[model samples]
Target: MVSPVAVPGGAVLGSAFAWGHGVNLRRLKYFVKIVDIGSLTQAAEVLFIAQPALSQQLATLEGEVRQQLLVRTKRGVTPTEAGKVLYRHAQIILRQCEQARVDMEAAGEGLSGQVSVGLAPGTAASALSLPLLRTVRARHPGILLYLNENYGTTLSELIMNGRMDLAVLYGDKAIHGLSFLPLLKEPLFLVGPRAMPAPAQPVKLADLRDIELFLPRPYNVVRKLVDAAFVRAGMVPRVVAEIESAFTLTAAIADGLGATILPASMAREVVAACGAWQFQIVDPVIEAPLALCQSDHLPLSEPAQAVKSILLELVVDLAGTFAATPEPELAALS
Candidate 1:
């Protein structure tokens, strides 16, 4: 990852401006990392550097931002109000540099090469990624696919290492070394065996306490939100088992192992297979935003750009069609 701090303090490509004294792109990036992990120690570990060096960078960033960016506490450090706003802006600035790299690479390649992509669980393989994937396959056959499922943080590391060319993932949680382009926001739905009875209309959040449920392991974004909903509803989930594979989890739900909370987009295909399991939008609703991600350090190959372009076009189409589809709680997103 190109650190924002790595740029010369006074370097200006287009405009004469002072970012900060002794500050560069890398430090600002470090600041963003601290905000995301909410801990100097964890961020340092991820960066694989000494804790003292990371802390020094944070101090430099805070001074440059001219505000108290983080609030220290027993658990971890959290960004202050101003800090949160700056983090978002920093992300935008960093992404522009990445896009520039993409553009430069695109200029020479003339659109014909391969890019292996890693799909974060729900992002690349569901109805959301299906159209984009199909379009890429049809329109850019030369591009090789190294499609695989992964967690958000894990995928980001792969992207950084150049193991994967790009990815589609949930965006609330930040991952370094990747640029996230917000595509569309989608909601989650409570899915259960159709053979099992359901309330007349959509069920309230509070109604799920006693129901036997099956859900993904805790790292899943949907699972986290589902757990939070249960907490808000003044109940705990009656989770009988947890599984990571969607095929296995859906199969379990279809076989009547238990009910599970899944994104509307992913639940769509499974519903047909569940024979008896039905799904409904839960009240006190939650929505997850999915985004397209690409490696910041590596220049995309020609075929990668073609596939990415087609995928982008497909994503635009899906976002429009998704708005009209009511059956699936989630709309297609890339």
Candidate 2:
């Protein structure tokens, strides 16, 4: 067992020695905690250690690196470029080492585990969710998935709260204490009653000024991007209704109620409906970027990592297919 005393460099414990000594896992843990919370005192409280001790360990690490890793700000201590770099490398090394240990013990055991997954409402059923489910089912039959879907804000909160193991979202800002890896950029589309006619190709924002629209409530990531384009065109959107369900919204559009601007993922069945139609939202074209977010404290288990890898593979496949065929060609199919 590694004794507490075996941990080198107190406070910022691992920061003292230069390139040549035994690895100090405890000190590295301290440095990572400080970086995550952005303050030595907060990091101390969380780690159940004293502030002075944390400070001393950090100071010692600075000595070894021969550079300040963080700078005191009014809000908290922000990462110095050096500190940021170290934090990244430390995280990678820590995760790799942990994975190595697990692999050594397991010797490639069968995948039989449970991972609770989350999906933001917007990304829940799209490429992120669908392809991932297929791959998981085929490759890791023994793995059980506990899945839930919700709005982006709520999903991010769930990951932070440990209510979820992982979440697929389309984030505009980096959530604190979680790691987000962008997977794909899903296109934006203008959906209307199937009878509603759009041009053979993409339509301009200014031209849609008189059209009535139904969409998810304002303030959502996609809505904001849509609003910005309308603002630039000096037009106010004529809102017909606010809806959450793409299925319901599609039904409404197909019934000739009103049109909607939505992610390509949401517009799928709606596009195929006889009465409803779809077109690309262009000029300043915008796409929602799908992301995978995981808790820093709860490093991804092997099963969770398998899901992530499958998600990325699908994203890569989509990218390659899109690159070979331009949007102009695909939108014409509708």
Largest TM-score belongs to which candidate? 2
Give lDDT: candidate 1, residue 332. Answer: 39
- Candidate 1, residue 293: how far the Cα is off, in Å: 1.5
Candidate 1: tens digits of C-alpha lDDT, residues 144-172 = 56566778778776676555667777764
What TM-score should be assigned to candidate 1? 0.60
Sliding window of 10 residues with minimal summed lDDT for model 2: 1-10
For every candidate in turn, the CA RMSD to the true structure comes to 10.2, 9.5
lDDT of 2 by residue, 249-314 (tens): 767887888788877766765677645667776766767766678876566777778776665566
TM-score, one value per model = 0.60, 0.61
List residue ranges in candidate 1 displaced over 4 A. 1-110, 123-125, 128-130, 296-303, 320-334
Give the deviation of candidate 2 from the true structure as CA RMSD.
9.5
Off by over 4 Å in 2: 1-108, 128-130, 199-201, 319-334
